[model samples]
Each structure stands twice: as C-alpha cells, then as structure tokens.
Target chain A: MKKKLVLYLLFPISFVACDNPAPEKKTEKIHLEKVNSNTDILAENPEIKLVGSRGFSYDFNDERFMQFYDLPVKNLHISIVDDQQHIQRLAMDLPKDKEAVNTLKTQLNKAYGQPGEDAGNDFSAFEEGDVLVWKGKDRLIAMITSKDFATAAKIEKAPKIDILFVKPEETNN
Target chain B: MNKLYTGALLGLAIAASSCGSKKIKIESINNRQQLDSVIALLPKTQVKVDSIPVRVLYMHLKGDFTFYGQPVKEFSIQTKDEQLQACTFDIEKGASDVLQQLENENGTGFKEYSNPILSWSTLPKKIQFSVQDFDGDLLTLSNKEKAAISLYFNNPVNNRITNIYKEIPPVTTTNDYQLEVDNSECGYRLYVNDFLVIDHAGARTLGVTADINPYLVKGKQQKVTVELLPGNDYDGNPRNRLHLESVVHVALKKSSKRSMFSSVVFDFRTPNADSMVREDAHSSRYIRASKFYGQLSAKVDHPFETDAVPYELPCYAAAVTDIRTIPDAKEKILAHYRKLQQAYLEKDSLQLEKLLYPLEKNLQTAWYWSKPIDGQTRWTNIMDKAREARDVKLEENVVLYTTPDGHFAKLLPAVYNKNPAFYLSKEDGFYPLDYYVNIDKNGDVQFAID
Candidate 1:
C-alpha cells in the first residue's frame, strides 16, 4: 500500500518533472484552504495557489501547458506570457462524478458563460481529447477530455471539467 | 515502472551514445586514501546531471588531500583564469564545520561556499570547449541560430546557475524577431531544440537578443520585452538547478537612441553571481550501470528466436549507380536485406563480412576498441550487444517500400522489441528496426544503417 501510494504520488511528480518545464520565476506559494471544490478555492483565494510542478506542452512546445491536478483531482493549469504573466491559456480538471461535474458546469457557466457560435453546439469538449470548451473575451477554455483510445488510455477517469484559455488570435474569432 | 521497461528506455539513449569514451589520468599523489577518494568521488557524472556522458576535464591535486573522505578539512579548486574557490557541502543540515575552521586558518582565503549545493571556480571548461567548437562554424550558421549560439557563448555567467541554450525554431527567419527560450532545466541536452521559447523557470523572467531591430515591426517606441528573474537565497532549494541568476539580452540597436527594440535592464539577480556545485555534475551512475547493469541485463535477456522469422527477398534490386537506373531494383534491394538478415541468423561469416557500411566499420573500431568486432564470428557478438539496437525481432509481415527511382527499396521492420542488452532504461522499448536498407537496381547494398 505504501509503495503503491508512493509510486502513484511520485509518479506524476517525477514523470511530469522529467518533461514538465519549471516556471521561470520563483514559484510563489499560497496554502490551500480546506475547500471542497476548486471553484470555491478560486473564489476565496485571490492569488494563484500552485500545488505541484508545471508540465510543458508536447504539441506546440510553447509550454502552453498548465497542469492543475497536483496531488489528486481538483486541479488547474494556466499558461501566461513569460514576462507579463498574462493568461495565454488556462485549463482545469475536476472530479468526473456526475454531481461534482454538475456543480462545476454551474460554476463555469456562471463565470465564463456559454460557448459562442463558432464553437457551434458541440463545444468540442471531450470529443478530440477536450470535453467542454468555451470562449471568453480574451481567453480560450478546454474542459474534460476523451480523445482516441490510445491517448485516453493514459487517464484513469476523465475529469469533470478541463478548461483552456488562450488569446483571441488563437481562436476563430 | 517495471525494471525491464525502465532499462529499455534508458537503453535507447545509452546504446546510441555507447560509442563515445574518454580516458582519465591521475598524476603521482602521495596520499593513497586521497587518491582513492578522489578517484571514487570525482569525474563520475551523477544521475541528477541528467545522466549525460561527462568527461573529466582536469583534477589538479596540491599535496593536501581528503581527511578520510569525510567532508575535507580544506578543499579548494582554482580555474585557469586564476580565480581561487573553496567549497563544502551544505552547512545547515548538521554539516560539520571542520572545513569552515580550516578555511579561516592561515588566511587560506577560503570562505563559506556560496550556493550551498553547487560551488565551482571560474567558467566550466566543458561549456568552454563546446563554445570553442561553436566558434568554428560561425559563418556557416544562419543569422538567427548564429545570434542564439553567440548569446549562449557570450553569457558565461549563466552557466553558474543554469545552462544557457539557443531556442531553435523549426524554420528560421519566420519573422524578424528574437525567438523565446525555456530557462528550466531538463535532461542531457546535446542540442537546444528540446526546450521551448519564452518558457523560462517562471513568468516575467527572460532576456532575448535579436539580430534585427524590433522597431521594424512597430516604429520608434516599443516596450522591448525585459524579463526579471526571481531573487532568493536558494540554499537547500531543490529547484535552484533550473534557473539562471539572470540572462542579458544584448540587442542590435539602431545608431541613435530612436531605434525600436531598445535596450532594457531588469536586475533581479546580483551580477557575477558565483558558480554552483552541481551534485549531479559527476557520472558515477553511468559508470556502475554501464559497466555492470548493462552487460548483466544483455547477457540475461532471453535468446530471441530470429532464425524462424519469415522474410522476402526481391529479385529486382541493385546498387544505386551515379547515372544508370537498374532493372530489377526492388528484387535486388530486397535480396540484399534478406541476405543481411540471413547472415545474422545463419551466422554466415562471408555475407556478414561484406555487409558493413564504412560508418558501421568506424563504429566497431570506436566502440569495441580493445578487441574490435572485426572477425567473421564476432559479428554475432556485435549484434548481440548492438549499441544502437536491442533484440530486433522481425515479424512475418514484411513491406518493401520502394524508392521513387525504382533503383532502391527500404525494408521496413514489421515489428521488433528493444530488449536492450546494455542500456539504462526502456520505457518505450519498441524500435521497428532502425536499419535503412538502400539497394541499387543492380542489387548492391550501397549505404545506410543496415
């Protein structure tokens, strides 16, 4: 049990560290308040509460990757412009349980609103790796993911919400 | 991860690089124990240095040696530039102060080692050698790559904290701007394309230089991107290995101050910050594993049944002539590949003897130095411990992808398992044979890995 736990916990940290790009600045830390959902934590804490090391993007190696699930579920990742720390893209992964997912959907809908026309009815969420996607004035969001069997096999249980935020230029708009 | 899987993964990197070797010579040392201690400790590249091959540059002993390998009473190393430096392991974690006391004695000019983890004097000669080599082809390099390589060589101070590297865009001159680069640490970098641009250790921290002025994009006053790195006493800080104290971006400024991409400064770190004492800079892990684990694993691997593997030989193949295209190109090429495989399976000395490429011959001489695999029977032994390959098992399904000229054919390996005989790890241990079989229309095995 102990070994398994160690492997499970350390695997993500080590595996991610092997490839993950360390943030450029001294990673400022804030203690995680005893909160239930990540939405509550985001609402309560004004500063960014980073849990573990950041993973870089394998696609367009810009490190446009931000991983949130550090120790376990209820995680978020955000890529920012290196100098300004401006949000280039943001993603979050939550619990996949129906109730937990519903709570997340409610929080997300209230916070960032619905998908625009370009996204059409499908939102591209969980279809080709991303579950639900949304567009904001200045950011792009990706939530939940279930791509091909080869890629999806890596994740045990798909998260409730996985979101990404990118600049308007990266979007169809 | 299973040990087999891990070993297979490390095998790919290890096997491919198993060809290069270095020699170490120690001069007369009075202290036997000191010599032993230095031999045991120094020059061995540690796992944390990303497990890359490290050659011993120099180890000069000045009579005084280790006090029984127990945190030397006094240890000092001087660089070629005549900068004297004294180092000790971290002092906070119950580390003995014997060295500290010894440092103060006789104005030994020793002080508490800065950067508790890694402390060294002057610039790294290894980095210096690489920089020297880069200077050879300065003119040939594209302007962008040339600038990045130049910046890396110029910024000697960055080596003290983090290695400076060029962020190569796939296609250069994409736009007339300096490309971004990741400042975070990663495993063994023979080249810099492995990292990303703009991804430094963290946000708001990076320095960039460009050959072209940025004002060309937007005239006069453009707020040139100046990143400011973090400042902290990173003593005992695990992440300090990743970030440079600061990296400067010396840009190509226009004659008068009116040019865009103007110079800017963000002093988040102290200038001339002392070099680090990398705990992983040595190669001990490589020594033990390469010498022991690699051989043992290879010897213990199950003998693969390569004999029964079904394959086809095309009759239409031959060697690639400078001008005339051959008649039976595919058949001739396939026959050559089949012959190579048959040579390996049947242990045929004659055919195998004729199949070595000039590069493969050089590889044999370089890799297997003491008793190079030049003999007929030695070919099997060579294949058994293939440095660039593990146990290559072929499946029945063979596809002969022909060349456009119909003079050559590529025999793609249907399936193969990378059972590395002498590698460290194998997470993704599947290489469908990296052999490039190129035969001419007349059926000559001309050139390639085959």
Candidate 2:
C-alpha cells in the first residue's frame, strides 16, 4: 500500500512541476518628461546645458536645408553668401562640461563630414571667456561666443580667421 | 487468482496514467491558445505618420516562424508600475477568435478589433490590433470558431522626421547662376550660366568678372565653359578628384561701358637674359669675371643696345615651313614644352610648372658650363648639336598669335638656334601689320638668332 501511494505521489508531483513554469523576469521602466521647457531640462542636466543665452542664427538662400547640427558655428555662417560685399555674423553657446564639448565635437564632425575634417580645433574653454572671429570670402565674417562667462572673459581672442582654400587632396568632397 | 489480481492492478495504473497525461496535454494547449490571442492584439495602431505605408506586427504562435534563432512567434513586452503591461502578442487561428470574444466582452473600454482572417496575399501577412487597456478577462472561443479564424495585427503609429523646405519664388536677378558640368574620368568641363560664375578645381579658383570686359561681353548673357583636365599624375582619380566650391552665372542687361584698354592691361617685362645668365652663373669664377667685364664695358657703351643685338642672323620665318617639333624630337625637348603648352591652353596653373620649368632649365645649364669660343655654350651647344643630328626639329614662318584679334604674336624658325629671334612688319607682306599695331608699343620684344 505504501509503495502504491509513493508511486501515485511521484506521478502527481511530476505533472505539477511540468505544468507550472517559472515566470519571465521583468525590465525596469522609465517615464519620459516633455522637452517643452528648455530651462527646466537644462537645470536637471546642467552638464549638457548650453552655457549662454545668445545663439547664432543661420539663413541659407537655398531654404531646402533646414537645420544643421554640430557644424563649427563659424563654417556654417560663411557658406551661404554669394557676393564678396555682404557681411555675415555668427555666435555659438558652448557646453560647460568636457563631456558636452566632446559630444558637440562628435556631432559637428558628423554634420560637416568632409568639409570639417581638416578644420583645426579652434575652440577653447578657459577660466574666463571664449570667443572666436574669422573673415570669410566676400567680406563675410564669423564669430563664436560661449558663456561659461568667466571662461569667456579669460580667453585671449584669436586673430581674425582668414578664409583658406583647402587643397583638392585635403578636401573631403 | 494471483494473475487476475495483477491484471486488475495493471489496468487501473494504465487508466490513471492515461487520464493524468491527457488532462495536462489539454491544459497546455488551452494556455498556449490564450497566449496566442493576446499576442495578435499587441501592435500599436493609431495614426499613420508617414506618407509611405509601413506596418510592423509581432506575435507568438505554434509553427515554424523564428527570429534570431529562438522559438518565438512574437514576444515584445514592457511593464510600467506594478501593472502587468502586455504590449506584444502571438496570433494563430484559435487565438484570434479568443481575442475577438474578449473585445466583445469588454465592449465599453476595449473597442479595438482586428481582422479575424489573415490575408497572406498582402506584402506583410499580418494585421495588428491594440487596446488601451485589458481588465483581467480570459479570452475564450469554440473549437469550430478557432478553426476558421486567423490572428491579425496593425503597426504602431510612426513618428519619423522629414525635411520640409519653405517655398520661395525663384529670383530673376542677374546674380543667380547654374553650373552645367560634364564630369569625365580625365577632368571636368564646367559651363557657367545665369548670375554668378565660379570655376574651382584643384587649388585654383577662377571667377568671371561681372563688369563688361573685352574678353567677356557683359549684358550679353555670355556662357563661359572651362575644361579642367587633371595635372600629369599630380594625384589620383583625376576626374572625380576635382570639386566645385560654388558657381555664379550673371546676365548683365547692359554691358558695362568699360573701355577695352581699362578692362585689359598689357603688362610686359623684357627678361634680361644676360642678367639672368650672370645671376645663374654667379657661383662660377669664369661667369663672375666675364659678367664683371661685361658690366664695366656695358656702362661705357650702350649696354642695352649691345645686349639687344644678336651676333648670329635671326632664323627667318621662311627657314622652316612648320614651327612644330617632329614626333621623334618630342621626347627630347618637347616634353617640358608640351607641359607648358597644356597649361597655357587650360589657363590655370597651380603647380607653377609653366613659370618654373623653362626658367629653371635655362638657369641650371647657364651656371653649370664655361664660356664656349664658337658661340656654343654647354646648353646652347647641345641645341646646336641636336639640330645637326636632326634630333631637335623646328619649323619656319610659324606664326604664334592670341585670338579674338591677335593680342600677342611671335614667329618661330624651323631649326633650333641659340639666339632665336625674328621680326615682321606690314611691309613684309608675310606679317599682319594691323595686328601688330593693335599691341602696345611698350610690349617687350627679345630676339634669339641661329
């Protein structure tokens, strides 16, 4: 009788084990907030925030292109003018942190692809201020400004940037 | 009696095992069918975001479908809070009917539905349905309903970014331009038309003057075509290697009333061959002594007059009928000349080869040798010997002139000579007097005689 009972118990146990399998492990979920208030987002991620209030405006005669990201704020300003007489003005808000600067550089590299490949790193982050100036074709001028106000104030402004034609071999196009 | 008891026991055991196994099998099948129905309704569907029709379906059903080598018909799930959020599903015939039945059960909250029958003819063989929420209701359907039903799902609402350009009326200003390019393996042929013209290749950039100039007639809406051929193996992939930075084509309504003289000024400098020779031979003692003596005598006499005169007679234009080197001689001296000719024809030289080659060769040879007694210096003597051997050939009366009206003109002898200078005038019948008069009187002239 004990043997029969043991056999019956074994069979039922095996059936139950096979019937109920372990449940799947779940993933942690994150709730995303809207990016409507730039200031609010900037406050939360201050490391990636733009340091200054003044940002450059770009107007391309060919409106087909809407916005370009990560372009050296300087190069994007001069590519538009057709005449030597017109003047161009540009400004940029630099990132405060090293990570942000690196990300910005990467983004600009991707955006400019060939044209920006040979462009030297003209940007610098110092204790006081940061500013860049350059002359482009046809009297077009480019300027870059960053807040980290103290850093900007401390920086020694570079001489006016002259438009240099990159040799054919050096150009990415 | 023992046999009968054993048989009875065996029969009972077999019946029990059979009953247990059948029940488990049925339960497992039922569980699977339920899961499949849930999967069929998992895809998110709302509004189409793109003009192009795109749909994605996920599901888990019993069959031969596998992804990334896993036995899954569909398995996509994400949870928020403690709620069991199931946003993915698997759909087969039976499972789809069950889902529809659930939709009907919760008519108020769960209003979404999908086609019960899967149409394999569509590009993607599945349709997806999604409900805002599920309220712990077990979906069920009859065997017959399951047999006729198939699961379908719809894709989630897509939110891909697209570029949109604001409409701007085409400007008709004379400043607008277009560049028509014939890009070939060897180089590019650029045609500039419209407002602004820019021809940039290699390191050189050439722009057309907007103001009406003699070489370019303004207001006429002139078309300038430039052929940029690759430099001799200066780099690789000559054709695709060149880039166009920008182009402008302009049509001036009234050609700028600029005088031809003001638009084009002739700047000529008579290269002092004697000075050049002296400078090049400065390192040599023989050259220094000769140059010192020559300068002293030149100051006493009219150095310009003596230096200008040729000891040998100038090679007449009549000496050779053709001014071209023979094909055989092309390999000898014509190699460098051919390069210069090419640069002149192209009208752009970034390598400065056109300016450097002839001057460099002359300077090198002049400094390296001592003065010869027979008017045969090392470099000059080589040319003399080459001419005798017929290795260097030249043609006579070969007229050289720039066109659109001869802006410049020269005559070459058929035979090579150390001093190869010759002149012509209206009186000579063979020369065009009108063209000569058009050139500025101050234009330089140097004669080399053989």
Candidate 3:
C-alpha cells in the first residue's frame, strides 16, 4: 500500500519537472525602451566609428567594414553602405551563449514586436546559416546561431550568434 | 498492478518530453512578415551604380605555366596556393629537427648509419613474412633468421636515435606506387630506396598514405626503411615515454587504373603483443632498436601498364612583360582587390565571376581538371560562405609572388606567408582569397591563368 502511494505521489512531480525545464539563467542584461532607428545607430552609439569606405556598390572584400568600439561581441562590423556612406547592414558575432541570445531576442521582441519566421536560403555575411528573422516596414533583421549541417559536421566550433540588419528593398531581390 | 501502470505512464511521459524538446532548428531564412506596430522609417532611395567611383579591370595572362597537380579548363577562385605549387616545392620539413637533435645529443655531426647485411637466409624460399612470424609474431622463420632480425633501439641516454633498415627483395611495377604508414604511438619517418618519402614527426596518426611513384624507379631494386624517434619537450629534451604504447605498420602499394583496390608490394610492422613490454615501449629508456625483414616477392607482374604512363602537361615557353614594369601596378592591384571585395559585399556574383575567371582557368589547368566549371554556381557558393564568415581581416601591404619571367604575379599577406592579404575567420579557421593577374598595355588588369 505504501509503495503504491509513493509511486502515485512521484508521478506528478516527474511530470511537472519534465514539462517545465527551468528557464535559463541570464548571461547578459539589456533594456530596450524603444526600437532603434537605423539612421540613429551611429549617432546614439558615439563610440561606433567608420573603419573605412568602399565604392558605392556593396562588396564583402572591401574597406567598407566598420569596427564596433569595445562591444562585448567578437568580429563586429558593418558591411553594407549607401552612396552617402550610411550603413545599410550591421553584423556582429556573439559567443555561443544561448541565454545571451535569448535575452537579446526578448528585448528585440519587446521593442519591435514578435519576430517573424525565417525567410529564405539567402547568403548572409553574418546573416547566413540557421537564423531567426524579423521584418519591419523598411528593414530586415536576422539572428544566426549555427551553420549548415554539412559544414558544422566537420568542425567542432562553438555556435555563434550573428545579428544582421538590412534595407527591405535590398532584401526583396 | 497499479505500480506497473504508473511506471509505464512515466516512461511514456519522459519519451514524449525528449522528442518534443528535440525540435529541428531552422535551416535557412525563408519567411517573414512586418509587425503592425514596429517602426520602420528609412526613406526609399534609388541607388545609382555609375555614380560610384569603383573601376573594373580586365584579366589577361601571357606565359607558359607549370601546374602543380592536375589541369583545369576554366577559371575558378581558389582559397589555397600551396596545393597549386609544383611538386618541387618542399612544403613540409619533417623529421629533420629530431634527427638534428639526435646528432647534437651524440656530440657529433649527422652521419649516415651503417646498413645491415643482406646475406643469404637459410629459410626456404616462398616462406613469406607475416605479422604472425615476426619477433612478436613470426612463424616460418628459423632461429637463425629470427636472430638476424635487429629489432631494438640503443639506450637514449648514451646512444643517439639511429636508422634501422631492412632490405626487401626488390620488386618492379608498371603502376603508380603509394606509401602507407600507420603509427599510433610515436613519430616515424619512412623511406623508399633511401629516398625520404614520409617524415611524420608531428602529431601521431593512425594511418597516412602518399604517392610514392615519384620516389620509385620502374624495373629497379626498391627498399623500405623506418626510423622511430622520441618526441621533444618545449625545451628540446626528449619527452618522457613512460607507459606509452605504439604499433607501426609501413607498406608500399601498387594501384591499378581500372580497379579501386591496390596490392601491397612490401610491408613492415612492429613486434607482436607478447614482445612489447612496458619498458620496451619507452623510447627514452630502451637500449635496443626493433628490426625485421619482409619476405616479399622479387617480381610481380602488374596486369595493367597504361596507368604507369605519366601525363605530360603543356608548359608555356614564352613570357609576357613583367607586372612590376607596368605603370602603377601596385595601385591597380589594390584597386582591383577592393573592387572584388565590394562585389562580394554586394552579392554581385557576375562581377565576381568576371574577375576570377583567369585564375580559375589556371587553377583548372594546374590541377588537370577537365570538367566544365559553372562560374555562377561556384561564385554563389563562395558568396554564401562569405555571408556566414565573420571576423574578416584585411591588410593593404601585400607580398607579390611573380613568375620567373615576371609575366604574372599573385598576392599574399606581406606578414603572413601562408594566406592572402584578406581572409575571413570562422571559428578558428580562415578562408583566404588571393589572385594572380597581369596588367595589359592599356593599363587594365588582365586576370592571369599562368
């Protein structure tokens, strides 16, 4: 009779535990009061500076990459440019920290609304690979966390999160 | 009955939870919709391409080029240069350091060790050497022949690492030869006919195979040699080899053109399990070297001979004007690279293809590849990789490697010799992009295939 009681009591606890895996501990803290305008990204972040310039057309191999000033990210740069040298896209890589990525995602959701489904198998500098996408009236965003299976299978590298932003017109093609 | 029912329910619940949690991640971005409340305030602006000051250059080549491995028909962008360098380019310096260290330890300069005698063995003919018949496992060898096997190293404290060789009955073949070695425990060097074919002294590997036809002569006597060396510490002292275990097997194989398999001509392996003691495995403490000879056939007739014939590549004899003599060559090269970089950023595969065409052809020719290359598809793949590649490093100062006659020049990083000036980092690896080109009389860049 006691064994039956104990087994019955254990069932609910196990079910609850399996159903609700504990929420991840926060690795970073970010507060987003409002959505950031692409035009204001440079003005708001005074430390952000233009690294160099390329011709008007976008080229991945040119001097158009910008350096993020002391950001906690690795390999953070902006590649896209307009004729006026305004940054059209920004790319930055975060260490494979799920909590941090989730935190940022939560902040983006709170500011910009819920993220949309992934769009296509398009080539992304920081935008490529397994990603979560969010679309705006004039902008497109992606959060890449992993590469293709074939490439990832051969290498045992930590997952990287790349956040990218581009103009909606450029993405239409 | 109640407990069994509960247990079964728990199992099902756990299984369901695991499967639910293992949801497949997204593969590519394909769908998205604009949120009603989200702010998007960029003014629509038309982009004008002609207003941009980027200049495009044409690619040309004028030289008899010597390809490294094979040949190709079209232009292709490549990531590595060493693979295309000719066979004569000595890319790896293996085993030389350890041998020099041994020479230094002996307080004497390096000298060739005495070769073991190849006197007539009393063992009857047709009794071949096998793993079971060696010192650890040899079956047909008489006590006299077993005694003749020199399988031990001298004491490392007193004696330097010496070369231990065994004479295999010479065999000739009309096919390409491959040297295969499996060394799990220690560093080793394998030789064919006294020619250093493999010097594997870095990280230990289970097996490695290399083309040995370049080292072997047809219709001539061939020999296989193995030299084992102790690893060194950061301070150059011989590393402790206590409790280490090693098994080495070296073989020469003849590959056929029509078939997928190759036959082993001769092979040498370590002693059997019974003979390997804990102390015997220690190279720092062992006082004797292990030696054994294979009873391989003196001659084996290969069924196919057409594979033996070498393919001769067409070498360019005439050379064009040197790129350095061209006016503002460096500036043009830098401009050309920047334009290419922009092409990548813009995802303009057509422009990228135009710039990379000559180099792709040269690479194809150098590699002896005859398949038709799809430039659009190749560039698309490159662009996709570039999209994912992060932490890009670029430099203005580039080192130019020109042809002997200065007809063409390729660019690499000035400080780093291995890769090009621009490389994209992913994890700990890098993707280097480099180009070789010639400047025409019209002051335009001609992509070179030579």
Candidate 4:
C-alpha cells in the first residue's frame, strides 16, 4: 500500500518534470546584400567613390560635380538597416546649379518622354524642391531640388537637386 | 527502505510546489496622502538642472515664408545727384509693368515710374506729397508706392506734389518696425541694407513676421528687399504658372510708445490673379527666372535710434573654440548626437528629459516665465516623435553655426546642412526637430535655447 501511495504521488510530479514542450514562436532573421559596409556599396556602384560613413549611412565623393545627364551630382548618401544589412534608401545630392538643372530636364525628357502625373510623393523630403518623377514597371526615379530653410532668415543656400531611385514597393506613393 | 524513499520524494515535491506558490505582500494605500507619506522615505530621482550664465535675445519670427529660387538682382534703386541717401526710394512696379499710369475724372493723374532719379537728401522728414484721384475717390496706392512717392519731392514748395498726401510719421529711438511677408508659391530672402534678415526658402504658402528694429540701422534709409526663390509644384516642376491661389504680400508697420497708432511704412502685394490675369498674361509675373516676378525692393527712412540689446550677446565663438579643446571633442559630440538618436529610437523619455533639461529650462526662463509649466504633455509629444523616428542613423559630420554676436551657437548634421540631426518620422515622412546645442561651462554639450 505504501508503494502504491508513492506511485500516485510520483505520477503528478513526473508530469510537472516534463518541462520541455513545443518550442515558442520566433522571428525569422532577414539577410540582405550590397549594403554590408562602405566596401560593399563601392563594389556595387563602381561609378562612385566613398567619402565618409556613420552607422549605417554612407556619403560618396563627388568633388568634381559629376554629371548624370546635366544634374551635377554633388554627393551620394546611402542608408541601411544595420541588423538586417538591407539598403533602406539612396539619394544623390545635386549641386544648386540652375543651368545644370535646365539641361537635366531636357535630358530626362529625351530619355524618358514627358513625365507622368506627379510622383513627388515617393520621398519624404519633396516638400519644397522642384520635383520630376519617372515611374517604370518595377522602379521609380525622382529628381528633387531640396532646400535648407532651417537656417536664419538671411542665409539662403541654393536648393540642390536630388535624384532618388527606389523600388516601387518601397515608396508610399 | 521503500517507505523512506517515498517520504523523501514527497518532501522534494512539496518543497518545489511551495517555492512556486510564494506570494508577495502588496500594501494598498487608501489615500493620496498615505501614498505620499510612504513615498517620502524613497530617494529622489529627479534630475537637477544646472544654472549657467547666458544672455538671450527674445526674438519672435512669424510669416508666410517660401523659397522660389531667384536672385535679388531684379530690383535696383538710384538717387539723382546723390542728394538722397542710398536706397532711399521704395519702388513697387508690377512684375510685368515698370510704368503704370493712373487717371481720374477730376483730371487728377500721375504717371507711375520706377528707377526714378531724385535729389532730396536734405528734405525734412514730413514732406508734402499728392495722390491721384480715381472716380471721385482717392487713388489707392501700395505702401511701397506710397513710400516711394517721397522720391517725387523734387521741390517741397510745389503745391501739385503736396495736394493730397499724408505725412509720414517721424521715427524715434523707441520705435519698432514690424515686418510681415506672405508668399504662397515660393520662398524668399529679406535683406535689410544688404544684410539678410529673413530667409524663408523652399516652402510654399507661409507668412513670416518679425521685428525689423534689430536689423535696421537707425538714422539711415532702411533698404528692404525680397528676392523670390524658385519653388516646386506637386509634381516637382518649377512653379512658374500663376493660379488663383498664388499670391505674395509683404508689409512693414511702424509703432512706438510715443504713438498709439501703428502705420504701415512699406507694403507690396501681387494683384488678385483672378481679376488681373487672363489665360494670355498668366506667365507674365509667374514666369520662372523672370526678373519681373522674382524681386521686390523698398526703402523707408528711420531717423531715430533702435535698441541694440537684440544685437548684443556673449561671444559664442569662444565657447565653440573652447569646446574643441577637449580631448576627442568631435567624437564626444558625435556620441552625444548618437545618444540622442538612440534615446529617441528606444522611446526613452527619462533619458531624453535628462538630455533636454538644459534646453527646456532655458526656454522656460526665457519664454515661459509668466506661464504655467506643462512639461508632461511636451514630454509625451517628444516620446511619440521618438517612437516615430523609425530607422534613423547619425551622420558622420557635424557642422556648427553661430550668431553674429557670438552669443549663441547651433550644431547641424552635415547631412541636414543647416538643420539639426534629429528628424521626427511621421506618416508623411521625416522632418527635423529644431535643436540648438552648445557646450556649457561644465564641458557638457547641452541645448542652447536662444
């Protein structure tokens, strides 16, 4: 009888002792490429050179005011997700050169016909700059003239054109 | 042996079950005072704000400011024989018309002219002038045109020039000049005597207003020029076409303790697009890069002294130089910016409050002395912004700018150029939160609220 009592008591304890159950749900880690580091960005876009970097953002050297069809590229900025190693955004800063801006408009018109309905909503920084947008099946290209109005009332810096290329799904509009 | 084994197993199971069932005693307070008494025994966790000596200029700027990129070369002024002080004439020629004539039934008329040559530097402040009549009523003129009428005072004794004009108020030391600008289509820069006093650029449909006293030179002709900046449309094209909504309005008002009434000293406004322009003339004043539509210039004579307190401040350049002397100052500053970015990313209000304490305190002291404190809501909004910042990263380069008096300084992320680095992400996208930070006497980088 004592042995029978021991078996009954041990049965509940044995159920509690079975601690391991089905594993809990976990987030699946994501992996991305062409944005691992400055080296990777340089390797992917051989046309440009790296200038500086901080965290997941990288600046490209464009000292000579490199031209991509009349838009004098002053510099390039690339942002990435550090943990996932994914490219979040890429922007090319254009010089505040009006002549160049005029020329680029002509060049863009020649290359990709007249622009369609306003696609300025693709980027967050499109509030003040003159914007030209081109939409393709899988890609969206936008040219923006950005301004720095945060300074005092006296210092008016010329607005620089920024050309942004991104996947269609990445944009809000 | 079996009984002893069963007894030991039972003891182990009971011990384990008892360990899991241990209950924590939670005391419930019945009233606020009871809770307060219980909390009085705890240590204080509130951050203490360190008071630092600094001079502040209370400047308030409000306006409908926009940027429609254009240079100030579109406007000019000249005085004949150098009799009048330079920039003494205020010109209000329409963008498309340099000469607009007015005629009335009373046979009273005046030919409007721009770039007029005048010689009247020695004339008294209250010179007589005449106005043209339109339909038995006074022919209304823009403040700029009215102010420019002074240039026509060739001979003060001439009755024709003095018939219907109102006398300009004399300027005094305590007088303040309030400047207001409204531009819906583009941004602009306002220059007082070639010194840039307002740069409202790259924005649309904004009105800016501020006191022009600090920027004005007393006893000198105040030259106020607005240069139109190029703006973009909904599709990012240059906004060169005039719509019903497009308009530009600029006015300057003069007031003082000695006078109960504030008189407009300068004004300029685009004619109502709905009434003035048809399909044919739409592009006349709205033309991109057109000199006619891109520049506005005016001049007013302020013969009294202005208060210099706004211009005078402690040297901020020295503070910047001193901060640079610290070991790894650049790294430290970058770290500070990163710390802020991280704090916002994590929605850490305590850390943000600690970091922003100096700024909040200075602002309270400078701007909110008479108001009640409501920091909780402010902190909540700040934390919400932090959570909305999304995926933000600190840029490598930091740029510093200082006030001319060297009393205040602000740091900017090179990526943002003139703006600070902390951008609050929103449903529409990201916009920067204005922060002017400096290294205090204690060598800690804190917000400079000026």
DockQ, 0 to 1 scale, candidate 2:
0.02
Give the per-residue lDDT digits (tens) of candidate 2, residues A24-143.
Answer: 322111111111111132223322212221111222111111122321221112211232112222222232334444454454345333122113433332212333323222221122
Identify the leading candidate in terms of lDDT. Answer: 4
Poorest lDDT segment (10 consecutive residues) of candidate 2 chain B? B157-166
Best by DockQ: 2
Output per-candidate TM-scores for chain A, rounded to 2 decimals: 0.40, 0.23, 0.47, 0.50
User: Residue by residue across B220-314, what tens digits does model 4's lDDT show?
Assistant: 45566655555454444655433333445677776543322345675765443333334464453443222234433222222333233222112
Candidate 2 Cα deviation (angstroms), residue A151: 17
Docking class of 1: incorrect
C-alpha lDDT values of all predictions: 0.30, 0.25, 0.39, 0.41
Between prediction 2 and prediction 3, the one with superior TM-score is: 3
Candidate ranking under lDDT, highest first, comes to 4, 3, 1, 2
Retained true contacts (fraction), each candidate: 0.00, 0.00, 0.00, 0.01
TM-score between model 4 and native? 0.30
TM-score of 3: 0.26
Q: Distance from true position, residue A117, model 2, in Å? A: 29
Best by TM-score: 4
- Pick by lDDT: 1 or 4, better one: 4
Cand. 4 Cα-lDDT: 0.41
